[model samples]
Target: MKTEEHKMKKERWEKDMMLEHRRIEMEEQRLQWEQEQEIMFCDVTTMDDDQRAYVLAKRAKIAKAMSASVGETASGESGV
Candidate 1:
């Protein structure tokens, strides 16, 4: 029936809209992550190769540790 087809079309349009919204949200998150990455590491000019590697590795480790603790501290603080 035409009415059934109309409802189906409307449902599909809504589903497509939600998908578009999620895509935009994910792009925003990706951009935010890139900005945070830039902020997390300081630029070291004229450092030797080994020293630069060590500094970068240390920063990455700290970032990883913070990321690992997310569910505990962040959620608890928000609820209080």
Candidate 2:
């Protein structure tokens, strides 16, 4: 039927529009992430040796604490 054909076309058009929007959003997010990484690199590059070492140590400590918290949560959930 003509109506069915028209409906199919509309659905296809909508799907294509959604895909294009998602692609654009992903590209924008990727650009933002790259910019953030560039800024972080610049900050570290400008840091003196002691400051860089302190930052690295703090990052490691935070990572370790987060890992421990995640492990605890996982174990607790499994027990439930």
Candidate 3:
């Protein structure tokens, strides 16, 4: 029936919209992460050797903590 067909089409359209929204959100998050990494790289470039090593160590510690919280290992494997 035409009414049933219309309902199916509407549901498909809504699901597609939701998927697109999620994709956009993921892309934004990726871009923000890349920007933060670039900023950190720039800071390291301006540092003396000891300062750079300290900053890198701090960054690594923070990364490990974040990965652990998300159930991932520091190497990015799932902590299964």
Candidate number achieving the greatest TM-score relative to the actual structure: 1
Instruction: Report the lDDT tens digits of candidate 2 across residue range 1-80.
Output: 99999999999999999999999999997996675455445466678999888767766665676578688888885311
lDDT per residue (tens digit) for residues 1-80 in model 1: 99999999999999999999999999997996776576466685767898788777777875776676675577665311
Clash count for each candidate, listed in order shown? 0, 0, 0
lDDT of 1: 0.76
Candidate 2, lDDT over the whole model: 0.75
Off by over 4 Å in 2: 43-80
Q: Considering lDDT, which of the candidate structures 1 and 3 is the better prediction for this target?
A: 3
The ten-residue window of minimal lDDT in model 2 covers 35-44
Best by lDDT: 3
Each candidate: RMSD: 7.5, 7.4, 5.5
- Model 1 off-target regions past 4 Å? 44-69, 72-80
Better of 1 and 2 by TM-score: 1
